[model samples]
Target: MTSNATSSGKTVASAVRDVFERIYGDPLKQLESLITATGLPVYKDPKTGALLWVDVRELRLRFTLSVNKLEKFIEGLRGGKLMYTQCRRCGAKYFPPQVDCPRCKASDVEWREVSTEGELVTWTVINVKPASFSHQGDYVVGIVKMPDGFNITAWIDADPKTLKPGMKMRLVVDRRPGEGYITYWFKPAF
Candidate 1:
């Protein structure tokens, strides 16, 4: 394959992933079908007769992001207002505020209050979750591209059974107890 790039110049894992994809590109569905049809968790190498056991172990991933650099974002959260960073030089905006603006190749950015109203563009429910979020019921993750063109990632507050793309959404900040951090979410616009 053509030379792939990583932010860190080291991408051995990525290269291995590329090799695996070249060998079995997107085996998720086909593998699932085989597992479903055979009723066994077994997969034998196509080229070699070596057998591989599909471990039933499940893994979930939840990440903690620090808002140390984006203190205005946290303030906005406490004020119940969504905020994003806009580059002072080029006017490039970032939803999940990044310190640097790749567009302008500049780190000089300013925080701006964003509109709460937006339309959901797409979403998915995490049926199988990671350990940290396992305690919580299946949550919906969605993206809403505001008028600023910066899409926000947050849990959408609505019944997963009734959610649809292009629904009206309002951004809101939620105080998660125990963890005690300010995070944002989407609520159905009634």
Candidate 2:
């Protein structure tokens, strides 16, 4: 397999392209199929038995992100380390990583590895997800207070019923499966 290809033997871009093709194959034919399947552009939910209307309008979005200022943070992820930025002048730390120190009005900042240990502040379970995350089961998002006095928000890779505030948490660097991108998340320390 090529370096850019995933274990499934398809590049991430190709997988996304396939999904788009399936969703938008001849709009008129899709509408006809839907109408024939349900006798109209409406259907009854299997679980709730509520009538649902099918939307004919479709929106496709593709965008690019500019990470020029936070290049070091991305590099740290590639290197298997979690990094944060700190203001050299006033000792202010940033988790999302800021290029300039807003507190001290100084551009000089220090890049350092973050401690994996943290405390869970709060969390919530997302039952209804957006289109992109619909494939996955319900997930819990949490805010963790790091030792450096900054909070990082990420998905908690654990059961939500067992979580509580002030519980020990650890930050971990990992690669997400479908999108195949490096990211960080929190998990129960013990």
Maximum-lDDT candidate: 2
Give each model a TM-score: 0.61, 0.75
Q: Per-residue lDDT of 26-135 in model 2, one digit per residue for the tens?
A: 76585788898877887677899998887867666888989988888989998868999999899989888897887879998999999989999999999987555654
lDDT of 1: 0.73
lDDT of 1 at 37: 90
Model 2 spans > 4 angstroms off? 1-28, 31-59
Worst 10 residues of 2 by lDDT: 1-10
Worst 10 residues of 1 by lDDT: 1-10
Predicted structure 2, TM vs. truth: 0.75
lDDT of 1 at 39: 87
Please, what is the whole-model Cα lDDT of each candidate in the order they appear? 0.73, 0.81
RMSD of each: 14.0, 5.6
Local lDDT at 173 for model 1: 70
